[model samples]
Target chain A: MRKFFPFFAVLIVFSMLLAACGGSAPTEAAPAAGGEEAAPATQSGSTLQTVMDRGKVICGVNKAVPGFGFLQEDGSYAGFDIDFCKALAAAIFGDPEGRVEYRPLTAKERFTALQTGEIDVLIRNTTWTLTRDTELGANFVATTFYDGQGFIVRKDSGITKLEDLDGATICVGAGTTTELNLADVFAARGISYTPLVFEGADEATGAYEEGRCDSYTTDKSGLVARRVVMADPEAHVILDETISKEPLGPVVRHGDDQWFDIVQWTVYATFTAEEFGITSANVDEIKATTENPSIKKLLGLEGDMGQKLGLSNDWAYNIIKYVGNYAEIYDRNLGPDQPTYIPRGLNSLYTDGGLLYAPPVR
Target chain B: MQGTVPESQEKIPFWRNEHTLQWIAQFTVLAGVLFVFWLLYANMQRQLEMLNLPISFKFLQINASFDIGESLIEYSRSDTYLRAYLVGVLNTIRVAVLGIIFATILGVIVGVARLSNNWLVNKLAAGYIEILRNIPLLVLLIFWYTGFFLKLPDVKEAINVGGTYLSRRGIAFPWPLPTETYATYRWVLWLGVALAVALGYALYRQGKKTGRMPLYGLWSLLLFLVVAGIGIVVLQPYVMDYPHLPDKGFNIIGGKTFSPEFMALLSGLVIYTSAFIAEVVRAGIQSVSKGQVEAARALGLNGFQTLRLVVFPQALRVIVPPMTSQYLNLTKNSSLAVAIGYPDIVHVYGTIINQSGRAVEMTMIMMATYLTFSLSTSAFMNWYNQKIKLVER
Candidate 1:
């Protein structure tokens, strides 16, 4: 032990200096701020301050969920979640180009990454569940999209709905809420099912395609993207009935209530912008002529909303100008006209008869 | 320096004394290491508190609410986190215990066979060691599971022979029916094993008195069967149970079921480690002097007799020490059970760390468990090694 100390002493000193110097840099602290710290105050909760100080918002994402959170062919992250990542960056630093650093994590590793302060905020389309919020010590903000359990079966199987398959094997991801829902749905229908659980969705989808399992069950959105790679994509059909509510949203660790409110309100700002007839192309025009008092206040044209949140007066303005409002982001990624071709469904603004109602800024 | 008295003595200052310098260096390093460790711990505590993470281990008492696929002791989701950890510990033990025994036996055979004069046998042994050891354990685990085992026919259409069920689920053989009479099974098995051991001792004692130890294995086998037969009769009517399809579900309802996951993981571990152990044993054997075997052969001993008496006993002194480490390595590598979902100690603790948010405590437990296993195995082998030392005549 003694002979090794001189060596270890140098190591200790070097590491200490490294940590101190690292605190000034941006990358290393992102995981520490976003992960196991379980609160952002130690690292990420004062996110805008960190970004302003460091000039980047660290975003945790998933590269597997195509159209929601996935990588494109060109080695860039592009999906619905990616847009929100841009939205958060645009809202805070007022620059959408390079203010965000995205780290894609596996489904099981996402929460630990957030708790340990690795990322500033998690926008990985994770489900908001009681166990996650309370027991795991994470705080889920407003829902970004409301989804439910659905399945896709080979078109030749002649199975169309949830109750159609009785003894068929279903492939689902292990350690996911999907596993539990798969069990409950089969139990409720008085049908017995063989659940072949894989560690990841990619593997499960592969197994299903190989006919190891008769069907694969996940969120309907996931099923669509999964089927595109199948040998016969048109042969597979997603069940119409959605079982088990899955409200996918962003999350931050508990504590730092102030930090939670900031990320939450940023998401609401996107919804609120869409509700007030806001779009990236029209944002500049509205900045000059918008007259509604609440809208005016929200856009930082009236009260000191920015001061209360420790943000710029035109924080929401920058968000709309750069990232676009909620509808614009959705249409670009998951809209029927987009390559993904998913319906807006519950993601539209309240004026469009959907559930995306944002609170009044005042 | 020549010193002090008229008798001429050497004296050195404390710092200049070699012994004193060594001591000082040791203590200084120890103190510095301890200080840095304490500092890291303090920083962790401060960070954890600052972030308001529940760093305390109050959550271990909470219900785990997660069922294990394979458990030696009774485990349920309703059990506490501590119980879940114990289940993992038991699985670690179960795999390690069986793997060590099987690897040692297989390793010795292949090790000895590698030097065989026979054309077919020597190359085969060499080939087995090279191919298995060169590939990584994870690849072999996948090969065992998805590549071969998962390709078994589904349970509903499973192959059944002589009341045994074989399917993708895994091989399920008949177990003794758990009847009131079958409760005496332990006594019968133990008594039979004890008799066999006693028979071996008797043969050794007879060898000391007379000039020869008869075929002790034969005596031991007869003793085991006689005792086992009598015990079985007394413990009467032990029935056999076989696996069959459940009336209303997909699960197998009867007989002893082995999940394919456990079989694949264990086989991979055993095969990979055995290959290394085989090389160790071969080197140990080859290191033994040819004179030892020549002397035994000149004494009119046959090949089997010479090997059992001369080659193996001496070679064990070398083989046992490294063999102990391979056993410990197998124990630690059991953590790979997670990749294949075997739910060993690391996997359960990983979940506990995630659920309870007790990273420091859980990590300490994992390290301590492995360390204790390694130390205990080393201690046993060390004792055995001392007993086998070549005492100078």
Candidate 2:
């Protein structure tokens, strides 16, 4: 027995190591497998059923950008992107409040979080690019905001144009489309600049504020939002030059078509509601009295559109009632009264001479 | 007859056999570990396939389309991801190597000072070591970057000393630029170095044979200087490139520039690592027995002679092992360069992972790269340690 003690000790150590390795595997695999078995209403690859079983939509969002997905002082998430996540929650769970788990992700990890099912949907003010759309295995829904890459310099720096930025150190967020655009635009125009890339937007802006960099570059909307948080907002001026198109939108993993359709129509429902001049206050009255065929279809009164999306008939109504229409979402977050206000130019609906056009619900 | 036979000599069933049990346990554990790994691999593959992002290295061939702030080699956005990865590798190596060199020098000085009889010197060294070693390296790096380097004046109001300019952007100094004749002069320089080495080796051997030791290092340095002087006189190998503020630009053109990020990271690494290394050196020196020092003194050796000849050689045997770990720590800590925007391998790989949604491949590559770096460093250090080990009779 004494001689066998050492052998038993060795066996225990080996088993512990094996347990350490094997333990995490089942925990990871078990949840998905169990969720699949527990929810039989939908197919296996459906994110909708998984989200239903979980009872909350795990939304990947940015926590820094003001009026887009910023975290508030009261520990609640606010802004346009946050509202869209709420809209998604409302569409799925019939209630926007308490149905979302906001996972604040960095620009580098947002897609990975989506691909790995860590988040049900990513509404992180992420841009829709060909590379992101195709290679990242993410399906971009309707463009929520049309933006462009722009630079902001100190008002007194006398840097008015792209050519004037030659040989200047520019601060930018790492792993962002803004970083790639700055590189491409500078290379194209024969401008030489040093990019001090920070891991987060706050760090980049902080560096720029310290005058360590002559300028900071990002999405124009982001610049507008971040500018309000600067020490002296009036001291910095965004350049007039637009470097690249940034059509920001929500994203989801590509394999789940039903989930993709649900997210897409949820965004369109907001657009359709805005186009029809439906407000959250008047949505119930309009649903009761409206005779228009499209309005009836959009409000889920005349058709099985919500059922087609594996949702209740009142899903679109829930979205409007809780999260509001597109215009209301825009006005709530980036309206004239808001500090992060940017005049809605290209983000306005197509009928109002902008790029936002959602296909008809019928 | 059975009772007379020893209980130890009786045959045991295979099921009850301890040897068989041990083997079974070993095989079971091995199989379990392999099965776990296989399960993880299969799960990853299935998930990746479902997402239409198969694990492959083909992303390396794609254009990186991102610009790094500083690189040792010429790189543009048109460069491949592989080239960008190499740039990151080179940047990491540059900081680690420079950090090791500077840290060693500072550490040795501080370590010696810690043991000095001078009260102020000893206390100061102790204070430096205690304060620096207690703080987290990341915080120290951030402090050095934002508090010290970034606090410098902006480029327009740069502090100029002679032809050098110091600003928040960087410190640009006048450096020698290679001319056409530098190619030919380089070979002559190498030849001079080789001749100096040979001469130094021969003199060392002669000194070993004779009772009197010669100044081989000084002689070798003088001979090399003479050769270099002749070469300089015959061929002007380089021209001094002075940095000057362009009338219309924000940056000083010409000469070499060390970005504030690089300086901050290097200084942080050097200072933080030097503290730990100083303790190692102190411990190593203290490990040398007091009796050995007394013996050297009895042999009429001075303090300096006792240290140089008797103490350091013996102390090194104890020092080299811990010192190897310190060097590795510095190398790995260089990855923290990402925090301050130093564009090290980890930072570059992060950007790559974002640009191409190939996180798995990039992470694996990063793991393999760091492993290679650590293994090679340890291998070289082990060789040196072995070389310096006391020879057994």
Candidate 3:
């Protein structure tokens, strides 16, 4: 027992030393504000380099949202957000088809995936909010789809307006802006309602369809998309009132400005191509014949615009050449002919009285 | 010889000594474990700091900014995350406690029935045990939820029995609501409870000394009820609040409600856990020696008395230790409430983690909460087991 005492003391001392080392190591390695500035020098293009080395861009996306990001029967992803991911892959590898791997993530898992470097970019239909931007250590590169919270109820339920929803049970997807917005708007109106929060949109919509809930609430676009797949789409109607602004977009981890720039410019490249009347079908012709300076620079006919973003000069050209412009991507996934078609109201170009305005490439 | 060390001990070097080597090995393992934990902690801290997300519990003070569907306490979107978390804790306790009680009762009955002389009853109990024990709890929970509860008729076509309403929305039943005079009536009720306990203790002691046991429990219950009856005449404590479905509204108001989520979760947990508990109880009963039952029968005791007074007390000694584990499993399995959208601790923690981005802190709190519940339950069970434990002179 006496001899064991010395070993116990040594063990205690060793553990204490380890604790001390662990406690102080983070302070030395991560100097808070100083770390952010110093991070870029050490890890500016790290994500890009990793993606290039791995030969595929790993994208976290939604498998549930129909028009934005949906998993198809053939195991391929096809949607508006997926197109953005493809556009990003095109910008990086000059090929979009085989250069992207999509990881379908829940709303609760999207931010964590970005922070943990599990995915290079998150293209889920995530709304941009102040708390998420500042607290979640995420950077919202650009708003690809401007949506707003809305409610959908059975047409025969007589719930035509928000006031009719008093004392109603509303089904909402958990851990999304839709849940918070439902609570806020209803509470502000002094409308007492029970929010049946489900972990996924599929469950929430299923609950609503089963009459377990009186109404289902989510983004207007999501409501449109989910409604189309219901047992009887014409039996339900989205309410006219838009409850809260939900600017959905792609997000990346903070402190990686180069990656952020790449994703941001990838989005802008699509918008600019649309503004310049360039489609995948017409991009090659435009690139060969256009003498306009901005078009030339955007199409990689002149200058080093893509090089400034740590890419080959043909990056923007590749994105347009493969994934097409914003208009083409939107029309393909959510066009008027599609079952989940949502009219491009705020998603249209600025010249067409919408909010999608891209800054000049030059 | 008294002062001299053993020859083997003398020849052993300190480095090769068993005691020293064992101590060194233990210390090395301990050091290795500590180093690994420290490495993980340091890595997490560094990553969080680099991402500008410092680990802080201050987020608990922020407004939860979300509404829980059903909470025992008065909660709103304006409440703090701490309050929301407490609501979650209370919900978990409610389900766990109720699940433990119901599961034990059903398990004991089924266990006793499994050994019955009737062929049909024994086979039915066996079938129940086999079927429920085989399926996973989460699948059963989802089946009970989506396939059973959610498939109930809509609010408009709700099945109403007496004053209670059952629908896909939930079950709403009449509950007692306190009137203004309830505060004054509560003291009399407490007095009755105290008097009943005192009388029961006195009767128990008298029975022990006289060598003839009395029905102390039944007498105490009767005494309490007589006192309660007299109190009710003098002061009415509560009025029954009957639920009423308004013609146009979606909800059944004015009474207590068991949300479909809670009902499904409780039923799933009880049914799943009762199967294992029934087997434990059956084994415990079987562990009681046959000689004890024969001896009780020879002493002229009835079949019920022999089983209750001789067999059960002995069986309890065997039943308790394993029974504690079943209780713990049921409590832990209640965390699956998240899958069914019950506002349990894990569900609320998920929301909090999303809203605050404090996954580390919230996870710690959730784990601590579950640990506290499990520890408290096992501690109580351990105490009870000690009290009923066999003693020898």
Candidate 4:
């Protein structure tokens, strides 16, 4: 008891300090701006200012899926989603090589990482679903790629179509849209199949290769990428069927409207740049001499749209000059020219008979 | 000790007083811990509110919108996430229970074999323990699932056992089908089990008082079957479906099938855990005194009887405590099912967290589940330990 005197004194002081710090935390976060919206104002402000001050945006992405968010052999990320991360950085810092930190995450860890501020934006090949949109407290910026669930089977397996896959054992990544869609579509078709789920697409592919499953299922885009890595590419084929709509895109946490706007408009700028025939190479020339009001406004030659989103006037110009237009990003990663080619069917510009239509820049 | 404290020697200030300071120290430490916890709670609340993320368990009631590969209970995409979680819990418990039983049997056998007089048997048991103990469990799980299970013949050339089959898909066995009349049959079976238990207890009590060995095991078996036989005759029509080799599909048609994931996970858990349990059992058996065994042998008990009646009872006393921990380990280790997608509780909750983004609430539920499992296992083991403990006058 006599020896405990100093310990008690120290403990009392520690508790006092903890109480003082905890007591003031709530009030400390309360006085940013805007009465009812002050929380979001401070939340969004602090996040945006942090990125600006830190000079790097932490982006969560998938390292496994090729053409969307694959980490290349050169120790650099090279994919469509990687370009989106670069585009966001370019919007903020006016340099495509702006300090962007990439945190490769799995499907299980991605959202929680975003919610915890471990990543500022998630640009993985994530599908926008109702539950994710409404419940996950994450905001989908815009659809970058339109994909759908499809099956890849050995050509000799005689599984030519979805109907032919009845009673088949399919390997899929657990917790993915592919897994859920497979269940929904199979049940709807009144076909029974054994689902062998894996945590990662890599493992599922490994199992598929070993013949643990009759077929491997994932996004058609993913299937293409996975198929290219097969031992014999021509030996397997992706079925010509799309089972579920998978609108893949970039996602940011909710409550940061300003930051969300920065990411959202950054993606939209790519489409608008493409819509106006402005590629990365000619973005500077167009910004300098364009007379078109929409292009001029979009390139930030007119209007304070960037200012409204708490960015510099040349934010759109920076995005185009750095990350290129949407078509360039797509063609570089997933076009017919690439090994993992995916047709730009619904991902093309609206005028090209696709569903990708950006809201008017003005 | 009380008298050593000189009474009324000095009237010290409360802070300087020994007993007062000791109480103060404890209370201060507890308060400090509580304050730290409060700080974390406040910080989480602030972050959640700032992010506009509602913290609620209401999402558990919403439709899962996902399908599990295998379920023991009725489950569909329309079922609530809570139901899905329940299915996962049931699956986990099933595996844990099965793993525990199989591991115990194998552990005891290998443990006994480890000390066998036969040099070959001893070396073989030692080899098994050494090899399995050295490798990481996850590596083994992946190896078995891919190198062995996946390498099995394709479904078209499944290894046939009667009408059942084993292939890369999985193994299927004949299972009794539940029909509309199964409810009545189930009641009859329950009644039979209850009656058998009562009669067995009566026979044991009679034998105990009379100092004669009771054939309680045989009597219980005969009585159970008699009651069940009467019920079956009354019911007249019962149905059982045998698994049939599929003519040309990847799955069996009529009977219950164990998914490859389940088989891999179960085999991985059982084989891995038995190695550690085998060591514990070996130590327990070795801890028994040689004098006691010799005394039993001097009493004209045969070697087997000396082991069964003398050595085993003592060894059990030493074994039960460590065996409780092994049971808990097996239960906790079942979480590795996520790697192979066995749809255990962790895997299911993980999917829920990914889909719904209720990371905080879902994590809390997961922690609570494992905590409950460990606590219940320890509680049961503690009760059994107390019963088996030697009474000292």
Candidate 5:
């Protein structure tokens, strides 16, 4: 044993050095995109083909957001984002109830999960930003929702706007645009407020409720979702001010253009279907009798856009038939009548005086 | 089989020779490790190339665009990620140092209590060790911040004593505000302290040479405070500001305050780590022979004198080595501050990793930082161990 001691020690050191070199090569080299995303192509299979072969789409989503992607008590996921995932699954499998495996990810883990090919697409409430697109090695397909950061405080706190938050403590979720935006706006306005940051929305909101912080900051849509769950929703009120623009949408890995195009058009198809007045309930009727060329092409009656995307011509029809159009998705989860009661404001179609404009399907 | 009669005289093949086999085995293992490493490197390179994501540290120069909840140094959103990271390192070191000091004192006290003749004190110390030792550190931190601290009274109804206040928001205490004159008088204060310590050392050395007892420690402390008091009176380096509740009293201002996150993390780490350290101290004290204690008593040394001069000095030999490990554990365990948003190194890195997408680089830096801290702590303890080591006659 004495004779081999030195050899064993050397062996252990060598292994450790080897492991360190392997583990940190990417991390040290790329400080911005945590080493997790540094080697995306290291995985064995093409994500697009892998999903097809497995007969399921592995979608990264948020299970915490109320109107976007919430996990239900029955163990089923229900939200606008879930519907979009189902729509993508239907586009591939030609059935709205097609197999989709939902993976819930936190704000920090979403991009890395996509970069490492752990999920085919991330449809969490992710904002499209220049740095995220270029540096994160992930591609944003299209904007599905236009949001803005807002603050919520108990009515008795008397904080009605950004100015009123001066010298007050603001609670925000860490590793999010809301936190960054709060810093920007507060610093710009010369407000001397302390920020209490938490790792999750629940923690941030909890701190706010406990009076540890005077205000809770998040996207306006999220504030509404969080408010509805409060024991006494009437006591708290969301501020009228919008702090920062947040355009949230689905995201896919950067390398595969084909996969990117597929997800992008899946979002656009919903927009076009909504524009053409095609509902899931009325899609079959429109396909049978539509005379308008764009409507016909969108429903795969007059064009081969689906074929170009490596799918059958009936892909859009399947998405609409199974997951519904944009209107159907919105009205189902976040419409004014829902528990969240979020207005379509900027999310409405361009024809309806909103920011959503779909390029002609033809 | 045919060469059995002359095998001793025959030249052996390299593979059959024991000396050559050992070298061959060593080289083979080394080569295999190298090959596996090479494979991993090649795979990562290929993947990065395909993904069009080149590894570069240039992103550290970019604006951090995020704010830390607390920082020791000046920081703004406009600062680079590197600066933000430095601030994070400072915060981490601050907590680690404070935690180590507090944990050691608490650990030693409870350790002695565990061995006390009094039943209640012994049972209480043992119970503390068992309870803190069993629960997970992360759960403890969560419980401390959310379950306990958050349950404190609202900010408007803060419990105030003198000028300080305690509320769910945080604990506020009086703070000193230094003006322009502080810079000139600070040096005088430092000089006074140094002179006092040097004078104390001289007295200690003189007493050692002669047979006199000077009580150097007590005198030195008094001398230091006297010199500092003179400097304060002459220069007026700073003004003390008392914390108070404003009219609305929503939050405490114009004072030094410990953020709820920082308090929870520090308490959880100090409390949880003290339990393990208490066990080490107990074992160390027990290792001193019973004969030594009885011998000291027979020499007319009282119980306190026997403990301080005989038991503790000898017990330190065994304690220092393990105490080093406990200090390191407390420092490393501080990474759990990220879970509660305490803005420690790990928490800051998590935000940077998400913002900059440099997960690999942040992880490497974090590992290097912890390693440096552990080594530095071990080196200091080892030096102390050498000073107290048994010198053979």
Candidate 6:
């Protein structure tokens, strides 16, 4: 018996191992994809109200995808997704600092984390799709960014368009709509292609640069991001065709219409802020002097909107003061005034006809 | 095994005993653990209901609306999610099976080389083992995929090895084509397997009955090949699926073009694992005593016979346990395909998680996959280990 102590210890460890393997929370078995609809009301029940009452928001986003979500070198979340998260926190709790917690997620883990209620809102530049909404049981908010699937190829390859590359091999990141869409669009067109799938964008793009595949496809923004770092930027060509409809947006699980309403209104508030000529730099001065009724109502002076949503009267004002509005966020993070210099394109204010329209501020 | 004798110094009272406390402590701990798990589970359920992250697997029945890159079984966007996952399982098994074969061969060769008297072979084996074992497998996979394979020239500039297509895209080779197509080919497959089994069994019976040295395994293999040839003639299920260039325009629609992800991962795991196996083999070989070698020599046996009959049979006793462990490691390492994007079980589950928006569920699935893999591998290896274990005197 004494001699068998080691075996006993090992047996104990192995049994524990089995237990650990089997012990994963059964609550998360996500109903085989289609069985989700019936349970929506139950899932979104009390958790939404608790988050609202707590006066802080848990936001999940990616920290690696270049334009959508990324942690800056200084260790703060900085990207299109981050800005939107900040906007929501600003609208809900007023001060972006005390009101928000940013949780970074990988491409694969984002959906499950959302479903498990690990985070309140997912502001990642995730594509809104049929399966995701219906099967995954997530409720998508307003479409924040309109994107398309595009490809990048070497300059000398002389691959002018998608049709020219019929028999070409295309590289794409794994576990993404980018991968599925690549196959679908090409196959639908009767063009044959072999897909070289990769786990990470960095790896996929590396292979593309090394000429492993004749072409590499991803979101149009990702193509531009990869192209900029190439040895010779002018050498690569982005094909003119945008194959898929990518309505990128913020998401939360179904239920809690109140919280959902608050998040949706936050996104609109930014666009409205921009329309009202509010920028982070001048928000303080405008509050002191601006007497316009519309501006005052937006800034929470004349209207009881903040009370209706259960927040401080000046929640939008604080959001504008701390996080800035739509145009300010874009210029700081992407426009020519900043580093990445991504054009404001479709993300500009609605008054200027670019689709960054906020719902009426009333 | 010695029975447990009560410790000499501590024969205290009934309730005030260390043994009694030990049982109490264990029960308490067990109860505590269960309580904790229960509380955690309860909390999670509450939060889930509160957040509206409805759980469902109805997604499996619906069209997956996705396509996998390299599939052994038929997979299309039109297929269900379950089919996609099945394809992933097949891909994992494919690489794992091939990796084990190559690693075992390489390990035996290198293990012997390490014990060689020749300085070159000995030093070379040592260096190979050291280099491979030191680097992490994840890093090696990346280096192989990115620095080596992916850097190779495109299809136009691909390095052709004896007319076989080897490029960053994949390795293409000549293979049999289906003359009668896949549906009719089932009979050929069944006939081929049946013939192979019959051939092996007959060879075994012949060896046992004739009392002559019958090359059982080899003879049976040959017979099986002949049967397969007849099956191919009768069924005419497939033609030569030549992987010639014209047939591989954009994709090798006929012959399989093995992806570089599969190749790089397979080679990396095999090479890395073989180094450890080499050490195990070397130790096993050395563990065979000097007396056996001398006895073989005294019997006037040649070098090969002495090594094969006496030394090898002895060494196998020590070799199997560690070698089984190596095989288990290779299977588990197949999950590293997630990092390199090989679309193995982990990768597919990851996509499921992302698509479904269920993190805990996806993670549980990933854990279950590796756990199941580990159990099956160990079970098979242990059974084999028992089969070859020495009958000690």
Please give, for every candidate in the order listed, the TM-score of chain B alone compared with the true chain B.
0.90, 0.93, 0.95, 0.92, 0.90, 0.83
True interface contacts retained by model 5: 0.50
**Per-residue lDDT for A1-362 in model 5, tens only?**
25875776687777777777676544423434445554343332256677889899999998888889998899899898999999999888888564899999888788778877789999988888898898888889999999999999999977777887777888888778888889999999998788777777777787888788889999898999989877789999999999899999999988777788788889999998888888999899989998998877888888797888877788999999999999999999998789987989889999889988877776
Per-model RMSD to reference: 4.9, 3.7, 4.1, 3.5, 5.3, 6.6
**Alpha-carbon DockQ of candidate 3:** 0.45
- lDDT per residue for candidate 3 within A1-362, as digits (tens), equals 45866867776777778777666534433444365557545666778888999999999998988888999899999899999999999999998888999999877777888888899999999999999999998999999999999999999998899999998999987788888988888888899899888888888888899898999999999999899889999999999999999999999999789999999999999999999898999988888889899999998879999899999999999999999999999999899988889899988898999999998999
Q: What DockQ does candidate 6 score?
A: 0.34
**lDDT of each residue in B1-393, candidate 6, tens digit only:** 112436775556756665665576667556656765775666566556545554456656666666677789888777877787788888998899999999999999999999999999999999999999999999888787777777766666566676577777778876766664556657666776777677778777886788654556776677667766776677777666655554334444445677888888988999999999999999999998898899889989779878877888879878987887898899888889887778887777777666555555656666777788778888887887788777679
Q: Which docking class does model 3 fall in?
A: acceptable
Runs of candidate 4 exceeding 4 Å displacement: A2-37, A283-308, A360-362, B1-10, B177-240
lDDT of each: 0.77, 0.89, 0.90, 0.86, 0.85, 0.75
DockQ score for candidate 4:
0.60
How would the docking of model 5 be graded?
Answer: acceptable
Better by DockQ, candidate 3 or 1: 3
Across residues A1-362, which tens digit of lDDT does each residue of candidate 2 receive?
45756865776676667667656533433454546343222233367777888899999999999999999899999999999999999998887789999999988889889888799999998999999999988999878999999999999989899999988889998899999999988998899898888998988999999888889999999999999999999999999999899999999888667888899999999998999999899999999999999999988898998898889988889999998999999999999999999999998999999888889888
Each prediction's TM-score against the native? 0.85, 0.92, 0.93, 0.90, 0.90, 0.81
Of the true contacts between chains A and B, what fraction does model 6 have? 0.55
Q: Each candidate's DockQ score against the native complex?
A: 0.24, 0.54, 0.45, 0.60, 0.40, 0.34
Native-vs-model 3 lDDT?
A: 0.90
Interface RMSD of each: 4.7, 3.4, 3.9, 2.2, 3.9, 5.9
Model 6 vs. true fold: TM: 0.81
Off by over 4 Å in 6: A1-58, A65-67, A72-77, A88-103, A117-120, A253-259, A337-345, B1-56, B178-255, B358-369
Against the true structure, whose TM-score is highest? 3
Error of 1 at A179 (Å): 5.0
The 10 consecutive residues of candidate 5 chain A with the worst lDDT sum are: A36-45
lDDT of 1 by residue, B268-349 (tens): 8889998999899998998889999999999999999988888988888888888888888888887787666566887677
Tell me the TM-score of model 5: 0.90
